[model samples]
Target: MARTTKPLTNTEVKQAKPKDKVYTLSDGGGLQLRVKPNGSKFWLFDYHRPYTKQRTCLSFGSFPDISLADARHNRDTSRELLAKNIDPKEYRDEENRINEAAHSNTLEHIAEKWLEVKKANVSADHATDTWRSLELHIFPSLGKVPIHKITAIKTIDIINPIAAKGNLETVKRLCQRLNEIMVYAVNTGLIASNPLAGIGKANQNPIKKHLPTLKPEQLPALLKTLAFASIKTTTRCVIEWQLHTMVRPSEAAGAQWNEIDFENNVWDIPAERMKSKKPHKVPLSDQALNLLELMKPISSHSKYIFPSNSDIKKHTNSSTANMALKRMGFENKLVAHGLRSIASTTLNEEGFDPDVIEAALAHTGKNEVRNAYNRALYLERRKPMMQWWSDHIEKAATGNMSLAGQKGLKVVSQ
Candidate 1:
């Protein structure tokens, strides 16, 4: 006959003394208080593996840390697993592995990992702004949530209040960043799917405001003033290059020498630097080339065609040209970005192919397929159009706007 184990009391467990050999005080149901020869006491559950029928011991915890009642409860839980044909130790191990994965795959942890991968691809200022925005807004609310557990509804809850505060643009940007992070998480196997997909549809659209720009008649006076302005020669050249190319102010300010191909007469802005995330080819007009040659003496020593006067190692700030424009007393009348508007308006009215003008401006297509096709199709037409625009600007600036039949270019009153 098999013997039945007796239950132990709290007093018996506490008062149990260690002998020369380690021994256990049974609390029935496989629960035991193990007393070491050196006087250490621990609660352990002894059981047989369900399949192998082999005896195994699992520690509940130290005595007092795990009271007698708690040990019995742990023993009963393990027995339940055994009854279900599962090994208690294996079950515990699996639970611990799942918990470890959950702790490491929190939204904040995965966002940091995603940011590490992005830091190399984006500009330093952009990367810094992205991280700062996350820290200030998104992280405070969602950082501790497991990436897999975050839902679209929860994301909206966090961002909608920001939109309600009239920062819809910020909310839109935040949603974009979150979508990128979640997409990274999905690609990396941290999450099975992106929860923030289509999140922008939930955000309020920001009001669109066009930048203040010059009328056709105002261009000549603005150009004449810029020519005689007491600003730095580099600033004048930046403004001229921007006007000729119709590139964004940031693109012109951050221009690097290596991106310029004087041999091909092209300025190849890298995909990472461009807002469109695709390489842009700007066909340099002869006038644009002349401006470059004039700028070479002042900026040739630096990597940037328009290096910052305060820090030659870095490119000029995007605001330099705009500030120069402000100083020229065109603060509300015009902006650096307005150059693109004026160029686009004038070129469209001058009978240049709209696609060619768009290509010269480096405006991205509505989708990937169209963008790829536009970049290849409009290269040749953009070359001649660029030259004509340059010549037109010079003629207009010199007060000779009557281009009635010159090179098939026509001037229309605005």
Candidate 2:
């Protein structure tokens, strides 16, 4: 006849004393209370390995910490798994691994991985700005939250304070960057799907504010102010360089000597330096060439044409022109970026070809075919327009009491 083992009770378990040797008190159904000579007790479940049918023991925990009821509950759970031909120990280990992964795969961790890949596609400054935005805004709230638990509601809540402060533009950018991170997670199989998609639609759209700029007729005043401004020679040259080239401030600040082709009169800006992420060939006018010639004596030894005032090894800061303008008493009246607006407005109002002007500005188009045509056929046609624009600047600078150019135009304030 088969023998039947009685289950352990809470009273009996608590009173059970350790013996001289190690032993176990069965609680029936493969459950037992193990006691050592040292008086330590542990809960064990003896069961057969699924499919293999080999017997092994699974540890639930220890006595007092794991009560009789808790041990029975664990035993029942294991028995259910055994009935389904699943090994309980294997299942527990897999659960542990998954839990560990979910804990480690935080939003900040995934964002860091995504940034490593993102840095290759964007400029260094842009990549740095992107990370800084996260550090200032998003990271404090949800950075450590696991990617799986990241919801659109949580993101909206985090950015709402920024929106409340009339910084919808920052809020908009935050949403864009967060969405990129989520999409990255989904693509890499870190998460099943993006939860923060279209979250920007939930917020009010930001009002567009154009940078403070001057009218085409007001060019003489700007040129006059810049010519007499109490700033460094390199700062003065960079402002004129940006004015003549019509490139962005950062592009002008980062100009390298190798990019200039004195023979061709073209400045070949690399794709990485451009906002459109395409290489641009700026047709250099005589005025632009003169600025380079003037800079040659000061920065001929360095790689950059516009080396920083404090650090010759590094290029000038992108904000140098703006700060110089402020010191010249044009604060809130105009900005370094407004220099492009001055060029664009003058070129467009002069009835120059819109496509040629856009090409000069390095503005891209959505139509790939037209973009290819512009890249091929626009270079020669843009030369005359560039020269015309430079001549216009020369005309404005002529009588402005500056070092170079002839004078005829009168200074007019806004």
Candidate 3:
């Protein structure tokens, strides 16, 4: 039943017919080619590895391009590698790893690396909002697709639905963000042009400007619970301080212990930390002072005045305090940010210098000449205004408003 052959012959290969016979021809010392009827031939080599007793079959290339003679030569080379106690599978995997690593140095990979680098410069809230616009709404549809594949039509498809949902602002913001990301991508040679460029003529709906600033009557109930009692301690203090200082919640939320000068009752916000990217000094009101004094026992040992109650290393998540407002039944009723409207309105009506109030809130370039001359101009005057506001707010929190103060208020009838 066993006929021994020393070497495979081309005549044997040519005479083969589909499924008729599978010829096992010994090419050399160990290599064999199983010639099939379908004209398909495969090389199989069996030999004992140097360190292992188990004999394994090593597959070389198929016939023609790999003749039986060459298979024998390759089999010898493989045995040489095996004699060095090296695994062919492991060696193949390592070679693949090197190739993959070389390929990962492409433009697309570098763009992602750039995004991670830029993330450190942006606030956590803005970073979340930006990445959401990029990843969910943008990426799945275009992620694995090369960066260059993003054309105007494709970008339009991605943004049009967002515009149609009456969220024109979000779409616009997303477009702007994509432009920025792609421009960075372009500069890094990831792509040539920003596909988002000049695509604005698309039928994008307009952004809705509906901030949740409350009516005068609603401010008291909002502040009352926020000042002393209802929400969690960290939440309450954050909202109260937010109400006290008209700065954006990000500026307040990211506040470090070193930024405040409690002894002087003056808080000088450094330029880099300011929304305007200019130094600002907020005069601390008695109420703002009291709020800080109360928070000291909780976080005096830490760097952030209000260290995230959740962890020792990380600051609070940007949404924690805002979400607290929604939980307290102030969803769309009173936004944590609407406190800016309260300050802008209250300060303007009080007959305190308009410029001073503007500077206190760190509004930039409203008075170009004044802005140019004075960066920290309000530090001294901001102190009294801040304290006066603390006094005025204490009255509001207790439901006692000066009638003179009431006249300037625009009351929305409930």
Residue 394's lDDT within candidate 2 is: 79
lDDT of 1 by residue, 18-132 (tens): 8999998888888888999999999988899987999999998998888888888888899999999999899999999987897779899998999999877775557778999
Error of 1 at 238 (Å): 1.9
Q: For all the candidates, what are their Cα RMSDs to the real structure?
A: 5.6, 3.3, 10.4
Q: Which residue pairs show backbone clashes in model 2?
A: 398-406, 398-407, 399-407
Sorted by TM-score, highest first, which candidate order results? Answer: 2, 1, 3
Clash counts per candidate, in order, are: 0, 3, 7
Q: What are the models' TM-scores? A: 0.77, 0.90, 0.66
lDDT of 2 by residue, 1-414 (tens): 989998889998998899999999999999999999999899999999988999899999999999999999999999999999899999999999988898899999999999999877777668888999999999999999999999998889999899999999999889999999999999998889999998999889999988998899989888878767788889988888898899999899999999999889999999889877888999998778877778888999999999988889999998899999999988888999999999999999999999999889988889978887897799999999999998888778655644334221234222
Among residues 3 or more apart in sequence or in different chains, the pairs in candidate 1 whose N, CA or C atoms overlap within 3 Å are: none
Better of 2 and 3 by lDDT: 2
Task: Tell me the spans in candidate 2 whose CA falls farther than 4 Å from its real position.
Answer: 151-154, 198-202, 401-414
Q: What are the per-residue Cα lDDT tens digits for candidate 3 across 36-136?
A: 77778888887765566577777787877787567777777776777788766456669788666545544345446766866656544666666766777
How high is the lDDT of residue 346 in model 2?
A: 91
The TM-score obtained by model 3 is 0.66
Report the lDDT of model 3 for residue 239.
69
Range of the 10 consecutive residues with the lowest summed lDDT in candidate 2: 405-414
Give the C-alpha lDDT of model 2. 0.89
